[model samples]
Target: MTFEWGDLFAGRISGMAASEIRELLKLIDRPEIISFAGGIPDPDLFPSAAMARAYEKIFQSNAGAGGALQYTISEGYTPLREWILGYMEGKGVRLGLDEVLVTSGSQQALDFIGKLLIGPGDLVAVTKPTYLGALQAFSPYEPRYVSIAMDDEGPVLADLEAALAARPKFLYLVPDFQNPNGVTVSADRREAIVALCAAAGVAIVEDAAYAELRYDGEALPSLAAIDAARNGGRPATVIHCGSFSKTVVPALRVGWVSAPRDVVNRLVLMKQAADLHTSTINQMVLHDVVSQIFEPHVKRLRVAYKERRDAMLAALDAHMPKGVTWTRPQGGMFVWIELAPGRCGVALLERAIKEANVAFVPGAAFFADRSGANTLRLSFSATKPDRIREGVRRIAGLLETVEA
Candidate 1:
């Protein structure tokens, strides 16, 4: 049964290292285990009934118009793009509808950007501990990655400048409640980064996938907003990618990138060739859900998730042993934990699963160089408050037992 195949699989896979998140998630599925893996939202938050209604409504209205079951333009449904632009305008990123391009998801937007701009050996700067998915999406392109150092407030300026001095094509950032680290760039840091990137002529790829999940403090302005604030009246150097996966249902896969009109045109062309378009049915359903039901549901998500975030933080504070530190995120799904030095999250994960019956993503998967062995990413988005507390308690007990 052996069939001869070429070395297509021989090439390096972009960011395709063993995914600790998924691996741990498998273990966490056991009835006895508590999972702090996968940055997924709770199913309770999904407006399943409303979504069904929206789906039915779309079919009823458009069945005669081919039921919107047919193929759509690669640029996406015009009304959805217009709605997204309107939503962004409220967030301070003033842009025309033409600048928005929808994709299957925000992940696809990253892949499309990598395909369009990144070639082998092209320099792309990323935060020291960054989004695992970003690394995955961009890795296949084989771009030479430069991991810029970061702090609690966000990317270190000197390091960013040093990386940008080499004239990288773009710098990737998860500005608000960042994926693994759960750190938001301070206002000053945001301003400094924008100013520096502007001077260096380095484009910034801003991933605001968790932007709407803010739980405390005033809403920080997005890097895209900062770009417009600083670089308005010129061709924009910021590529803003975002998704409803966090705010709404991930399965719907509605995400968009707001760039200059020229950039949008190119992405539209690329997208046309990629999948022809995102699903027309999904887009139509989303339009209906978004216009009628999505926003209010998001407000509910905020209230519920904030409580969960608080619970996780409190559990970590009360239960984790000394010398173990974690991020106190105001919003978003993850909390980056730094275990006592020399403790590899990967190595500890086995004990955590088999002994403690708990799981969290090992930090190594998020690093480009596999240097963060002592780090771990715990996602609070999926688990409930009681379970979050229970999970931390169980893991904390394991740490103590392992020590003894």
Candidate 2:
């Protein structure tokens, strides 16, 4: 007498889709494979030693001072929230501590936003090739995704307005060094999108995970900042998510949401239910570390990653086959590429693995309709410069064979 597993599930589970990027990662573990697939930051850049020292400091003096191991407010550690508020102000984003809610990672903010706003069949506006993780995050709620046109500068405002006209529940944007594409929204475009969304009564989920890593050119203002400025004296219609994962350390899982005070209160309530708040012990350690030592760590990352980004760009220019075009990202980890029409990035992966011995994320996974068959994403953050050059050369060789 066997019990059926299908009988125990909700109908929503049937439509739930798996993340292709996560699936692709299974093949990326081999040392022989030069993978440009993951959005992972450099492991070497993590300040493990600094973190250790900070943890010691927290325990020696402050562990029982606030019961670091004991559960605290679901709103997260106040000192950390205060630090983030101060930091945002330093970056020109005006916000109060009450408007920020500490999340487990920026990714969890995505999950929470989806949890709060998305309902069945709701419209969600996204770039044609947006972040796959967002799609995975929101899939369970079963929103109908609408893709807006994107260019080198960012999402086209006309297309975005058209998408908004459909009355989307919200628009999710990576805006700063967008995942997979590695494009940042220009100041003008950012203003246009913000104004359009605000007027149309559409919410904007600004995922600025890679905001701090700009390699060249002036830093662009955050959508949250622009939204705050536009919405009278308070932030409105913008739910901003940021993380230390890309900027500092991923393992510690420190991320945050900055939204209107009321919205943040709701998120905090939801957070209390989710995990009873992100680890307080880790939060205390981070408060100490970021305040005392994070700047130098970020500086080292900038120097090392800039060289790797440049190496990938140089290699692509020298090695990629004709008709294969790629974005030269100013900062952040990825570069988006497009093969000549009629080519399939996933189909080419078999050859890439057996012949070139390199791996890349097929761009189709980044699209809702899975139509960018000719596209691919390369990550320069984790790989060293020499390996980047070698990987690009091998990928080019594979492309030549496929094109031939």
Candidate 3:
């Protein structure tokens, strides 16, 4: 007799679904398709030489390959933790080594946060069109989401105040160049949000995955930075998650959570329970590479990604049909487009891939409440300037017929 696997599965598995971007990636791998479906860093810009040198150094170290392959503490490798501390200090958060815990990626940090704070049916607050990956991470815990409406400057204060009344476990935000929509929360809005959440005794979960990938404008203070300033350089109200994926390389799978020690201590236990810590060799290589060329590598990315961004915007301006509007992101990979009323982004994506040989993520996937049917997100991070222009033009050409 066959057993029913579904019956044995956890109930939380029901809330989890496959990522749309991941699904789209499978379809867009053909050379004929000009795809903007994935918000990923371009591999051509990766610091391959530096990374190779890093791996070489690991073997040449006094401890040799055995030590490199050996398990590290759940808290993470020491030199990497020290580097993270200094990086946080540069950003004004002033985190000590104990306050930081390295995870496999920021995605893991989010999952841990969900496990730590969300009870079944607990309240979780997210931006109206927030990152889909965050929703996927938090959904496994089965929290009821309260979507906060946002303006160009970020979350609306009145809406956030109303959301605060319900007392969500945390206000999750991608404050700097937010994913999908690419709207950076203004400095004033960030401070106000930090203050409002702190006043309500709510926690703020800050996802800064794209913070280092800024292509234009001065960087605004992060939610964690604002909260730290208010609490005298201690992480009081915000649990900040940062990633090396967008900055250095995604394959290394290195990222971290910077918070108060107590919270980190709890997460460290969870880290131990989950995977017994991130790969020791990967962390060692990441530390070596970052120590050598982190800043200059990031600078090169900004320049290349900025060109792609400009190309996509210019193509949209020149080719997009009437009744379309998109966000002018200060610095990020995405450009969010709102099609003329009654045009669903999903339908457009279907036609775009089949007919126009182009693809993008439908905006509805990014919504917690599953709103924004007429919107879509196009990513410029992974494509070259020419390909970006061609993809935008193709999408725009499709919109002309669909919108009409």
lDDT of 1 by residue, 1-404 (tens): 77666445646563356665666667645778888888899988898988898767665655634858887788889889988988888877788877999999999999999888898889999999999888888888888988988898899998998999999889999999999999999999998998899899888999999988989998888888888877653338889998989988999898999998988899998898888999888888788788887678888998999999999999999999988998999898889999888777887778888787788888888888778999988888888889899999988887777656
Off by over 4 Å in 1: 1-15, 27-29, 61-65, 233-235
Which digits, one per residue and each the tens of the lDDT, describe model 2 over residues 221-241?
888888877765467878889
> Which regions of candidate 2 are displaced past 4 Å?
61-66
lDDT of the candidates, in the order given: 0.86, 0.87, 0.91
Which 10-residue span in candidate 2 carries the lowest summed lDDT?
Answer: 57-66
Which candidate do you rate higher for lDDT, 1 or 2? Answer: 2
**In candidate 3, what are the lDDT values of residues 5-49, reduced to their tens digit?**
989999999899999999988865699988899988888888999
- Model 2: residue 189 alpha-carbon error in angstroms: 0.5
Q: Which of candidates 1 and 3 is the stronger one according to TM-score?
A: 3
**By lDDT, who's the top model here?**
3
